[model samples]
Target chain A: MAVAADGRAAVAQTAVAAESRAVSSNEIIAEFVDVHRHYKMGDNVVRALNGVSMKVSKGDYLTIMGRSGSGKSTMLNLLGCLDRPTRGEYRVGGRDVSKLDDDALSNVRGHEIGFIFQSFNLIPQLTVLENLEVPLFYQGRVGAESREKAEYLADRVGLGQRLAHKPLELSGGQQQRVAIARALMNDPLFLLADEATGNLDSNTEAEILDLFDDLRPDGVTIVMVTHNPTVAQRADRTLWLKDGEVEKLVTNADRADAAPTEESL
Target chain B: MIRDTWRIVRLGLKSLMLHKLRSALTTAGILFGVASVIAMLAVGEGAKQDALERFQDMGVTNLIARSKKPAETATSNSQSLWSALSYGLLYAEADLIQASLPTSVVARVREAKRPMIRGEHFHTSIIVGTEPSFLELTNMQVREGRWLGDIDDRRLANVCVLGATLTRLLFPLENPMDQTVLIGDDDRYRVVGVLSEQGRTAGAGSTPYDECMFIPLHTHQRRFGDVNTTRSGGSFSRERVELAEVKVKMPSSEDVAAGAQVIRDLLAQRIEETGDVLVTVPLELLKQEEESKRMFNIVLAVIASISLLVGGIGIMNVMLATVTERTREIGIRRALGAKKKHVVQQFLVEAGVLSALGGVVGVTLGVGLPFLITTWFAQKTIILPQHVMLAFSISAAVGVVFGLYPAWRAANMDPVEALRHE
Candidate 1:
């Protein structure tokens, strides 16, 4: 039964890829063209990423999956604008971010991409409300509008009453929720989450995944990097990386078929 | 930008609040530094003002030619007792000084120590023989009756002006004016005037003017003669001195140095046997004192700066530890879109606020310490507003200077590496 569902998901993924190619360039939120990332360790040049090309459209929920040395970390760093590709073009919101300087890259990171860590990296010193205002504070837009937006995002994440509480005072799942609210505070082009649910228990993981699922249809783009197949199965599409190369592109149908019990839950 | 700065500063303050004891200890370094700076400056200022007052009391434009007993030479030992060693300012020298410095006002003074008697009330005090111009030159005022005029001096009238202290001792209840006071055993003088009360610090010479009695020069010359004798340890010493002091007031301060030089040259030629004349220019002493005071103030400032240096080192030490402890927090802020400059600004603001708080407390303590010193220890101290501002500014500057290294280290961290740190 799983094999039959996998065959259906393969056919659905080919169709979705064709449909994405038919969409206009303006609809693409981020695009990586023939990107390469190399690091020098002592005397050896380690090729982290080589000539990989992909596109993410607006409102797309995509996931990148790989093992330890497969360069998924490099992909997340590049996508979040925290780093630049060595010799390729990385465009976010129609601007080439790969050629930008540190300050400009910081600007893109502040206004365009929101990040969530596996540890739920909320500033321990700040309250949940202050954590949500971090990105807007960097953009020098911290005023009534930012406060109102932070309040609305807090309510949306079901943490409205806990706005004044610190991150250390909250549970792991609750901290992750606050991180999610902080990621959406700037209304960025996409949310880049690295191992978003790796630290949570089974039940809390399901809840966070359900929250991601609820946000997907609302036209909020999310790009997540993780090693767990179960977590990757929730996204609209999955990109599998192996030895600095794209191994496979899995679609929603394939993920749903591979884990029917989880999909049903 | 201002609102953003306020947010960052508030964030810095919040982070500093995490380690309350550490923060307070670090603040204490700056506190003592600022307080010491202010206190030292106040002491230096007080000393300078005291010196200025003493110099002003001596008449800044006046040159004094005083008589001094020459050291006994081998030939002076051959002189017999009662012959009286005549080594001092003479009436002839005074006339020559008046002739040489025509643009100056010269006042001659003959002083003697004698026991004054009013009935049975006897008090030993200085008796000063001076002309009428002496009152105007010394800036003295008469409280009752009238001062001696030229007619009283020419007629050789036996009238005297009693000092404030002497009047109280002699008259007690009745007015001292028109009273008779006996000098030595037989000489009697009528009191024509009483001097007003001058404060303790008003008299800068050997004898306070408030405790002396003034008599006309002719009357003193006729009654007491030009010789004074004293017996000590079974040995009799006598001095034939005509004038004890000659005070010359120059027309302008610019002429004082030249006039003093001219008087010294004139005395050097006349008194060939020994250097019996002592010439002192108050204006020169005032200049030398002012120069030394400036040096003293500079030394005090240097010492104060060293304390600030030590305080800055303390701040640096605390900030370095904070940076090490908050490596992960810096990584989080960097990930949340804080630039390197933003990280630097946040840490610098934290340091600045810590030192500024210390400076405020230190200024309060610094200003209060002088009052305590003045009240309890009887030491004069003056706290100028500029001194407080200077000390506070230096402390804040020390914070920034010392905080630079740690802030730079924080801003230069690799975000991935920092986040990975435990």
Candidate 2:
């Protein structure tokens, strides 16, 4: 029933998530159906995301865009599993997770989600390799193999030689790269990026987008929220929100068929 | 589980290292609290030991009766003073004390005033005439040669044992063994033994036994004749005294109280109208000291607890501020899939490590302070391992207890709001 707005992501759904009977979807890893969130300010209830619905599929590079008071932040928060829906159903891995308790929700967040922030919120005291191991740390995966994986991710992010350096010692672009590598630590179902390039220069922003493109072949799905049109154009589809509802889901038709572009920085 | 704890602890340490000066300053409160606990207890223990040794030297199971002149005799008739003024323990009284407690050992004593000369060295000192049992009753050890025996008393021998101090004065450059010391113009004695130094028997002054010259009772009675005469301002006065004191040592500590009561009853009339015929029981003194020491220890424990309480408060204050300052970090950790319990664990470990570091340093200082106190103040100090352990464990507990509120506050923060914190 929540498949109309983004049909490509909700393609093979056969059962309702709200009824506790989610049908198999090889593509859809996360879905939000008729979600509503409200904040009480004095005597009035203010609706943040009024009946918003969306779906994110495997290997799908999707971006969310909207103006102020458009429920953009609410969607980003819900997609990251940082907040559960006040009403309606949100599911991950064919399981309804909106009603899960704090501990179970924490487990889901730990094992199934990865988050990247615009400001690159790396713990300032930890070395680059240690920061890359944080998500696995919560999953009790902090051992010899985790170290090797961290090293590999550091090299993948072009930070191999700077593994022992703290975030404060790195440039803003390099720190953001480290944050991206850290987000990939647990091999989450999808990467949730909140204005992932909002703080970087245009040249560095292009480099990060290229890195996302490089990871797409490995079946790494990405869902980014941003206001920049150029950044939104890089994703396969951009969901635009207005007044807490889907204004439109614009497909970047050219991205599906174009070869990887080599942009000199 | 151990590995996880080790990782979190390492993380906490790294976080604390970010603000080294602040962490160290916060730790100071606990350090001094622990140090003062151990050091103060050591000093108190040392003082108790000093008192215990003195009471032991006084012989806890022994009773001492000393003779003092009657107070009314200070202004006796001037004409009567010229005849004879003798008011003290007579030889008969010494016999009474011995017969009263048959199982006890009794030592009778008489003091004589005279000047002794040994070649060029001349010293004026008190001569103590006592039985052979005096050495055992008073706990004095002879340093050289043998003490006076039964044969010397029977033969009225002119042999004497010099007190430790007197031996030094009379024979500075030669051995005093078998040396002749003239007691006055008319009497001389051969030194049989020299005594070992007796530390302050009671308090802050040298022992009276150190300066005394001991002679056999039979010899003292025959030579001095019980009458001492003095001539001054063309007037002469004579005082006759038979015995100075009687020290009685009971067979066991249990016999002391009853024995003391017996002496009190027998000497009741002799003690009338004067502070003379005074009796001293060291066991009673020892009991009284134990009671006072227990009270003193309670007071010390209270003071130590107050110091630690204040130290715990200091830790809480610093931790609260730290949680507030690092709200952003807490949010970031939470966003990265950290649970509330994990956040709590991190901060708790930080607080524990901080105070435990202080405890370690405090134990070192506490153990060292007693040595410094012993050397500088010339007082004994004892450090018990249990005391060290108690202080250390309490300090660590203080940190955890005090850290609880701050850590809970950090863990329960709204992650979205915290992430927005500037």
Candidate 3:
């Protein structure tokens, strides 16, 4: 928390440190161009995010890693459409969203971005299937068709038999699976996970990551924010943030065909 | 839209069901409020109905003038003791009143207390002297035999009609028809008719002819005379009263007021002198009763509304607490794409469902409470449809109205802060 307060002056120098390094022809689904988010805390202005740029493309898996003061949470909030950048621009599906009003931003969140939280934030009052229906419900798409879709997603997460169970009744891993199924309800452009395995045991975290891996062939895009290096290394590429700015971008060396260029395909 | 509302309402119900005891206690507040409202109004309506029945029994178009023995008559005539003080409605006044209301029926009545005896059955009661028109004016019908006719009055025959209750008191077992009752000393009047039972409550001036004996007007005048002598514990008194009461029946209900005014004007001079003749107009009393009833209903509504307001406040209190407790849930919903209005609607619908449930049960209890009152308390109760509707709608509106502040607070909470709420 104190690092975040002291990092305000370092934002300017680190802002120019990193940029997208993927040499692929995949279509861009979402992009952030030099985004800055500033808040005036009493007498001090806290620069949470300063001049950071990144891109998420179709069929790609990327992770954002930073210390507590490195704007990891802010990046998650921005990616989820829960907060807008104070300067620069955020685009989803090639349209600028930072200037949209609350309702319109909420519409973008419902239709484009899917979020998975560290706490597996499924509404406890709702059953697994009902939790899966939340995203579509906001779009007024609840009916037999949505219910069928929910059943299909629940089965995909291996929770078909637990559709009627409340989130509180499920284990941390099972609850996170429900959250994942819920995210897929809208067929979002990409999944934005904020420390998705922060509350899980090692065994469950590996299982959930494998579930993410299984969706890769289906052209599912993902953007994750985590502070754990082991979790970050599982992604195709890792973007590091320091002092509210991207510090470096590293492509995992062990992953074969790390960049799926058109020529390689 | 209706389907959407119904869906929201169903969801609200499920959420409320999670805290069953809390919801039930909140509902009790409204239940009792609605119950008391219906019950109180019912009691008021019942009292009004009772009064209405009394006035209706007295006959709306009829004006009664009863003879009262003036206090002055007692003071002045005490010197003589036996001079037979003359007071009350004079036979002359009856004639004048008959002439003025030419289209009306005037039944003049005279009362003579006498000991009448039949086969081993003897009692002392008032023997009423009246014409044939008395039956029609009093709304009394003959159950058996025949009522006295004009010929019986002209001949001064000793024929009488026994009141339904008096027949039981005097005759007991034997049929009163063709029987004879001996009045005073050697004055025998045959019972020629029996009146149907009149379930009227006797009012002031000793009315309700059910306990009286009806005889020919001339027979009473010829045999008993105008003077009534009484000797109580060696104290002697004699009073002369030509008529006991005069009932004037108007052509219709609308004519009662004008007819009463004409009669009042005619007797104005005599009333000032003796103050013994009191005229009773029932129509004016009925109108006054109507006005007072409206005031009573208004009072009842105000009282009922206050109770419902208290109930509404109870709902508001519960909803505010529920919103505070569900802050994290609101944040989760907002993160999952729920808008501010959605959060507000969710809580508002929950409150509405709570109160509407109370209304349903409240109506059931309110409707049944009157029957219990009639059975256990023996109090008359009338349940009005509009009252039920008013109470139910008000209860529902109370939920929505009281829920506004809490729902707005929930909707306006900062999502970022709420998400971090433990």
The candidates' DockQ values read 0.48, 0.49, 0.42
Q: Kindly give the stretch of ten consecutive residues in candidate 3 chain B with the minimal lDDT sum.
A: B202-211
Model 1, B274-391: lDDT tens digits are: 7787888888988899899899999989998898898899999999999999998888788778888988998899998888878988898889888888888776888999999999
Best by lDDT: 1
Q: For candidate 2, what is the DockQ-based docking class?
A: medium
Second chain only: TM-score per model?
0.94, 0.89, 0.91
Model 2 segments beyond 4 Å from truth? Answer: A1-27, A256-265, B1-4, B69-79, B83-100, B202-207, B225-242, B254-273, B294-305
Model 2, C-alpha of A130: deviation from truth (Å): 1.9
Question: What TM-score number comes out for model 3?
Answer: 0.88
Highest TM-score against the true fold, candidate: 1
Off by more than 4 A, model 3: A1-26, A254-265, B1-6, B71-78, B202-204, B269-274
Error of 3 at B47 (Å): 1.3
DockQ winner, 2 or 3:
2
Q: Give per-residue CA lDDT, model 1, range A1-265, as digits (tens).
A: 3433443354345436534544563489899999999999999999999888888988788899989899998888889877789999998876899989777877888877788999998989899989999988888878876776777677778887898999999999999999998988766778999999999999999999999988765567899999988898788788888989887777777645653231210
* Candidate 1's DockQ: 0.48
* B407: Cα error in model 1, Å: 1.3
Model 1: residues >4 Å from true position, as ranges? Answer: A1-26, A254-265, B200-205, B269-273
Give the proportion of true interface contacts each model preserves, from 0 to 1.
0.49, 0.51, 0.39
lDDT of 2 by residue, B14-102 (tens): 98898899889878888988998999889888888878888898889899887866665545555475567777787888888889899
